[model samples]
Target chain A: MKSVPNRILLLLSLLGFASALTIVFYPLFKKPIHTSVASSMRLKIPRIGIDAAVESVGTSPDGAMDVPQNLDDVAWFNLGPRPGAVGSAVIDGHSGWSHGIPAVFDNLYTIQKGDTILVQDQNGITTTFVVRDVKTYDPKANASAVFTSSDGKTHLNLITCTGPWSAIQKTHVSRLVVFSDMEK
Target chain B: MVIVTMVMTMLASFASPLIASAATTPSLGSAATYGILSSTYTNTTAGTTINGDVGFTTGPALLPGGTHNNYGSGSPYATAGSDQANALSNINNQACTFTFAPGAIDLATDTTHGTIGVYTPGVYCTSGPGAASIGTAGIILSGIGTYIFKIDGALTSVANSAVTLQGASACDVFWAPTQATTLGADSTFVGTNIDASGITLESNVGWKGQALAFGGTVTTVVDDTITVPSCTSQTPIPGGSGTAGTISGGCLWTGPNPCSSYGPQPQKIQIAPVAIAAVPVPVATLPNTGLPPDTKNNTSSVIIISSLSALLLITYIVRGRKIS
Candidate 1:
């Protein structure tokens, strides 16, 4: 009779050991993902103190994407997929004024790694993104990374004029683009 | 057909080394034209001499007492006049495309020259509120490589803010400042300076490259010397076969008569190892125990729970043996 009880205790201890092991290992396994595609309507970045409405824009007659006339407003490439969609979406703003004044993205260069970027769509759904990389491109260079479609994952690229001002061209010398990946 | 294919493959194998060697130097397009170019006006004090052309296309103004040699229609600059415009455009286009080194030291907040080290060819930038200042100890750029310093903010040089070069040239160094760029008195500098707003060369600054202000304005104090690197010696062959210098030791400053102290002189500096990114812990290779990687926080809890269960099992077994 004692042996029976002892055996039951041993079985219970084994079950307890297995449960403890499972609890410890659960996080190592890949977690299930909950993701969806939605049209981005508003963008917010608390770290950068940016909360702005997004406007849809298309390519201009010169084959370049049209820019927002208002410096504060950000223009999104309308021809591409929405921000939370299965591909890359682009948004751009002015970093400085033609007269050497500060523009909307004057402080955008202050962003750091691991900061969160929130994008809300017309449907009221929000997608969160984590910054992965920040890069600057010459105004006249070809930047396929900011525009090209990527089916592998969803990304959001924010761009603005940066670098030295060109008196001859009356424009910034380079463009600064911040790349973020959608958080799972 | 088989023999021809084999021969072609052999030729390609032999050419691989040549191609690899040629890839090190990046091309600077039309940007190489001016030793010093300004859009509005160029102002200089007496005794300021420029070896290359001094141009202000927009304002067509240059301050008196500064001599500009080796530019304009009669000068020997390779890309002068109309060709220079294209070269500037080319440099503006290509310069931004290159990959800047990661974790570039923030030299802006450090108004006082604090950084001292040897840097390799790559884009160094300052994104902070304060302008980037080349600290007092100065910086040594090593290797015959291209170096681009892009300051989105303003740029200030303290006195004796020296820029020493190893195997580099004035033509290969580029300084792009978004706002005002001021060189302190008696500061030594290298590279073509493309300042957007304006540039003020403090008294007696020794500049070894072009000082260009896109807005067409450059202000130089008394006794500032600007030497433009010569085109014949500055231009690198397409195949990277020959350099611009034919001097016995190395290519000295480019000009009809090379300046004695103007070229890159050898310097000793401690080169820091390139920063390596942290590798993520592998999940797939973990033993099928299905637990998260044994990080310190996770391991602590796991060990406690495991220890408790093991103790209970041992107690049960010991008690059972005693009873038996």
Candidate 2:
């Protein structure tokens, strides 16, 4: 009889442990989203822990989109609704050149759908985003606004290279983007 | 009856003591006959004059615009010359020197300088490296004991060329093509550098975007004294007054925002200018560029959801006995 009660208690404890584990890892998989502050945080590109190459390239109005040589090459700025609003948040780096990671967006294309991304802001806070879609675009193409959602939805659109490598310009004609959404 | 009629007639003829007395000295914008400096003037508050240079205690005001205005000093400036401004056009086609018409404009009196017409038809700034034919050399204001370089024009940067702000005073500006509506009366594009320093959207001045977007960039000079506020979700309006200004959509100031939400970093605004001070450099001592305003919607909703989740978690744990 005692064994039976103890067994019941053990099962309950295990169930509780599983629940706790689910809640703990929920942010990495499925987590509750709070639009208020989550959407309010600035969606920053450039992961907090990842070390990116800083390149130096000439300046252009189109900005260092496909090609960048240094931190100066990549025009760093914000585009999300607020700083850390959910949805797909994006920060673009140069892909043409670099010293460490060389390509501004070399790893961007490597990011598979459902991958997790964290954006750290000026307050040392991190807003997480998960990859959802990856789209490719051409430089001359006027489709950069794809990252912007019409319904006040915030998203990060990352731009980079894809397809067979080219020798003439050294890269492909079209650009690939890894689209992510706020992990909810 | 005749006396009464005369009095009424005189009143009508005299009008209400009108201030219009001085006829315009010159046509507002482009000069006739191929001129050296061509520009445009766009003013949201019609009749706000782009005074020629304010009287400087020292030498000539840099670009013949205005003078000695500091940040938040309420110094009025001219608008981006609407049509298209070719300050030193043909720098590529022709051999002409172009300088960013001075900005430290302080409209002590209603004045006008540079050009007086529409400028740069299409976008943010007149797109060009002047065709790269303009060469790398650019205008530079070397010395100063307080001077002004007023520009009611867009200082567009070429491929190799850049517009440099070297004055020691606040270069008050009134308009940018994207932020101010007067530039694009019937347009459907977003203007670049809307966040350019000294830019403010007054009385719904520059509100239109490609599709109702807010968030333009402005560059501000920093100093050791600038404070870096903690990042928060709080959106503080630009000016102290509520009605006068707004937190329009989203804004990213050079300094850190204390009301930031989520994960924000310690954006040290003063660091930019302060870091340069250590270099013992001249212009290097100043912060080079600035940030643009960020945007979107749904941010508030997302925040709400985050709050509720936290509350639920707190309540569940607090109300229930300890579940080891």
Q: Which candidate leads in DockQ?
A: 1
Predicted complex 2: DockQ: 0.02
Q: What are the per-residue Cα lDDT tens digits for candidate 2 across B22-68?
A: 10011111111111111121122211111121111111111111111
- Alpha-carbon TM-score of each model against the true structure: 0.37, 0.29
Candidate 2's residue-wise lDDT over A1-184, tens digit each?
Answer: 2233434544554555555555444445533221111111233344423333222112234433223323222322222222244222334554433211233344556667776766543334665777787777664565535434443344655555555545465445666766666655
- Give the CAPRI rating of model 1: incorrect
Docking class of 2: incorrect
Interface RMSD of each: 23.5, 18.0
Q: Which ten residues in a row have the lowest lDDT in candidate 2 chain B?
A: B277-286
Question: Fnat of each prediction?
Answer: 0.11, 0.00
User: What DockQ does every candidate get?
Assistant: 0.05, 0.02
